[model samples]
Target: MKTDDLITVLARDSSPPWRFRPVLLAAICGSIIAAAALFFAGIGFRPDIAEALGSGRFLFKFVVTITLAVTASLAVGALGSPAGGVRRRGLLLAIAPALLAGAALLELAAIPQSQWGRSLVGHNARFCLTLIPLLAVGPLACFLAALRFGAPANPGLAGAVAGLAASGIAATFYAANCDDDSPLFVMTWYPIATMLVVLAGYVIGRKLLRW
Candidate 1:
């Protein structure tokens, strides 16, 4: 079939007019459940989680990660609409990194220079890199499949956004398991894992999301 014909088939709205947000919402919820299931099965929270919750650095991890997840998911959800509201909210994606950066600066100020290296290295760097993408597998698959229900002009961007959302979700779960709550570690390793997922999404999106 011709490219135009494929686009016509995908862009056509022959069936009843259904909302994409609700479907997107379902995808988000279902993705969470899937990721959580995989998480608990393989990696539960750190044994000291009860005590870790009291630490400001530890609690802040959730703040950054959940913000990433929410903002990216919001952007991905808007990709289906003709208005392209994702562009406006697209800046929201930076909020997580901004928060992390600010927190990292504060951490550097508060701690001695000698400790910065240790804090950045952390005990779980390898696990951090491995588990985040592993946990993101389910969410990324769901997000990619869900993208088909919408008409995103830039499928690659949409997929990358979905990857961000998936990575956020996965990182949130992995954070609980990770003992290293330093912003330095999160800033270094988490983005690497996220980029991996996003790269996969972009490559896959080019093929899978072609109208």
Candidate 2:
């Protein structure tokens, strides 16, 4: 083709590229909805959900998970944009962890040292590790799919944030069935499981999120 014709064609096509944030949001929300439905259908809330929700420990579980989800979601949205400034705001995700750490310390302070081990171990150590990452599958997959819509400067970090969001969603669902309401359990095992997901995200993002 002639240069003039090529230039004319290129100039004529000046439409904006598709927006990534909306796609990311939809994918994340859709995945969460699907995961929640599956979780409820397969493993509904604990038998004592009414009583559990009323308890301070039970309520705090939701607080931590929701905070992580909120902050990570914000970071994910920012990272999805090509403009690339997630670092500044991404630190906010630490709020949930910091709060949990503080609570864990307070719990340690109040309880006898002998029982600290039991509180950390809880009743669901095996199950907690298995189920949280298991539940994280859907949201992680969806977040990766969403990342495909945009160009992130650091795929690993983007993936990490995605993992964080997924972990939060997964933990929230897990909370419904988990009978162990100890802050010590949530603070310890939950973060462990979430970090596993984040590592998985980092590895996968390194491979898949590249342009």
In order of appearance, the predictions have TM-scores of: 0.91, 0.88
Among all windows of ten consecutive residues in candidate 1, which has the lowest summed lDDT? 10-19
Per-residue lDDT, model 1, residue 14, is 35
C-alpha root-mean-square deviation, candidate 1: 3.5
The reply for model 1, stretches above 4 Å from the true place, is: 1-18, 82-85
Model 2 scores a TM of 0.88
Query: Could you give candidate 2's per-residue lDDT for residues 54-97 as a string of tens digits?
Result: 79878888889989888887888888754555777757988899
lDDT of each: 0.87, 0.84
Per-candidate Cα RMSD to the true structure, in Å, reads 3.5, 5.7
Tell me the RMSD of model 2 versus the true structure.
5.7
Checking candidate 1 for backbone clashes, the offending pairs are none
For lDDT, the strongest prediction is 1
- Return the top candidate by TM-score: 1
